[model samples]
Target: MPLSDDALDQLFREARTHSAWLPKPVDDALLRQLFSLAAMGPTSANSSPGRFVFVKSAEAKAQLKPALSPGNVEKTMAAPVTVIVGMDMAFYDYLPKLFPHTDARSWFVGNDDLIRATAQRNSSLQGAYLIMAARSLGLDAGPMSGFDAAKVDETFFAGTTIKSNFLINLGYGDHAKLHARNPRLSFDEAARIA
Candidate 1:
């Protein structure tokens, strides 16, 4: 069955990209649940390359600070959690477990171009899933790309095969600080029938 109108409003129409957040903290359990929800989104060959880093501690935020562009710094730091969504370049290595049938891994093995493109695209889709998951859980999200990816990888992923994709701030938003919602393209203007 389709979701109710109220559910659609909660997940889409009424939801906004929030920058100013309430001082309320997000629970660890909720974050874990959020990931489980997001993980259900599909990826090619079940590559599921998205790796997230939840930066909440003062030290972690400080380490993330210099990487953020000037405009993104304050809001990101003030939020309860900042997720560094990274793509695991070696995601194909797990196809044996994730796909579990035939030789799905062979499709990407030794093909650096395919690996990079697929990892980037699927991880971004996962990041969008993360945003929806946050909203579904009564949290607001501010997904952004205004940061230095290399710096973020250095500070957060270090020795891992993961490479930073984007950042998303999550928490209870201070709606009082919200600006008027921006306009979006109407379906007729943005899409075409074949």
Candidate 2:
């Protein structure tokens, strides 16, 4: 069944990319819950490539600071948590467990290009799922692609097969600080029917 109007509004219409935050903290359990909800979203062949790093500690946040563009730094630092959404290149290794009906892992084992493409595409979808999951849980999100991905990968995913895709600052938003909601393209302008 489709969600009710209120649920839809909370997840889309009323949802904004929050730039200012309330002076509140996001609990670890809530973060875990957000991940659990997001993980349920689908991906091709069940290749769950998204990996998240919740940068909540001051030290970790500091490590992340240098990679942020000037515009993203202040709001990112002020938020309760900044989630580094990354794509795991070796995600196919878990296919035996995630998509266990057959030998799915063998499909990508020797195909670097296919693995890279699938990982990037599915992880981006998973990041979108994370945004919706956060909204459903009454948290605001600011998804940003302004940061230096290579720097973020070096700082956060070094020695791992993960590559940073984007960042999301998560917290209770201060509605008063939001700019007016901008106009969106109408369906006719944004979509096409074959």
Candidate 3:
């Protein structure tokens, strides 16, 4: 369902990082809609490198359990779904079409360092887009990085060059789980004009 302006503001500005979730599942249809919306967000040269793996079932969730920090384990396990946000290291393979004007593929080829940096940076941006997209769709987000990356890679990305960048718990969040909103720096404190 498309949100109203008030709903959008509440979802984006007032939404909290919920550690607990109600027992509500995130269906594939919803995920499809989320990706459809989030994919429209810009990426450098249209690299669109983000990849998502929705861990929903017991078996799949088990693969992620060991990677989570103890503090995050219970909440993540309780959430209806957790999404592994990853990036394809070979994102440039599609660049001929994604950035047709230049030799974009050549920009990444043989440059492991460049590929790594670009994939991580772009994919993280896409992850943020995913969070906003979920909120727009009336879902809550708990973007987390408190996990063992190596363990996640072993369990989820085995046999693939995709690397796990972050995880997000998805569901109807329990508002009681939220902490108070923290303060933000003022414009003068955070920005500067040239």
- lDDT (10s digit) by residue, model 2, range 1-194: 99999999999989999999998999999999999999999999999999999999999999999999999999999999999999999999999999999999999998999999999999999999999999999999999989999999999999999999989999999999999999999989999999
TM-score per prediction, in order, is 0.98, 0.97, 0.93
Models sorted by TM-score, best on top: 1, 2, 3
lDDT of 3 by residue, 84-106 (tens): 99999999998999899999899
**Full-model lDDT for every candidate:** 0.95, 0.96, 0.91
Clashing pairs in 1: none
Worst 10 residues of 2 by lDDT: 142-151
Best by TM-score: 1
What are the clash counts of all predictions, listed in order? 0, 0, 0
- Using lDDT as the measure, the top candidate is 2
Candidate 1 lDDT, 3-48, residue by residue in tens:
9998899899999999999999999999999999999999988899
Question: What overall lDDT, based on C-alpha atoms, would model 2 receive against the true structure?
Answer: 0.96
